[model samples]
Target: MGSRNSDRIPIQMRRRKCETVADMAAQGWDVLSKCQACGLVMRVNLKMIAKVSGPATSLWNRKQRCRRVGCTGFIEFQGRAPDMHWHETLAAPSDGEM
Candidate 1:
């Protein structure tokens, strides 16, 4: 007699392993810190490190909102450094402005 589904332990174990790897990859970048002055949020790749600091800070706290009154440019934490052109968008506030 041939092995049936009940005897397919190796197949089931392989499937479980694949699922675990997929789950790990899915847990990508999570917000880590925020700059209160500019409302810029910093995100760190969670899966990269085994442990993370700043347990007191909430993940959502790093979410950046639109700086402009009506502009929809939401702040985001990028893994790599941004290009020089991107910095041009940040307008310097005048002496009177906060």
Candidate 2:
């Protein structure tokens, strides 16, 4: 029973790798918005874009909200899985925490 449960968890995680924002209402990924010219960073509401663009759009090279008088940067949208942390991803056995 333990083995079976472990097996399903991996499969579930794999299924959640829905890269496209196609399912706008899906609650797994978080989008981060960053501006290069103004150094502005924030989380954006994708609901508006998803509705207009049919939810299959990637925020990869989008430009928005940087209308400052002298700012001339494009907003970069990045989607990331909420469950992953950089430190936990890999560790050497010598690190001892493992």
How high is the CA lDDT of each candidate model? Answer: 0.33, 0.50
What's the count of clashing pairs in each model shown? 0, 0
User: Which portions of model 2 miss their true places by more than 4 Å?
Assistant: 1-16, 24-27, 61-65, 86-98
Give me the displacement of residue 10 in model 2, in angstroms. Answer: 17
Clashing pairs in 2: none
Top-lDDT structure, candidate number: 2
TM-score per model over all chains: 0.20, 0.53
Measure candidate 1: CA RMSD. Answer: 18.4
For model 2 the local lDDT of residue 54 reads 66
Question: How does candidate 2 score on lDDT?
Answer: 0.50
Give the per-residue lDDT of model 1 (tens digit) for 1-98.
67345332332232232222223234332223334455655444544433443222222213456465655555543221111112111222233232
Candidate 1 residue pairs in clash (backbone atoms < 3 Å) = none
- Candidate 1: list runs displaced more than 4 Å: 1-25, 29-32, 39-41, 48-50, 54-58, 61-98
Compared with the true structure, what per-residue lDDT tens digits does model 2 show for residues 21-59?
A: 654237555666776678676765667667787677654
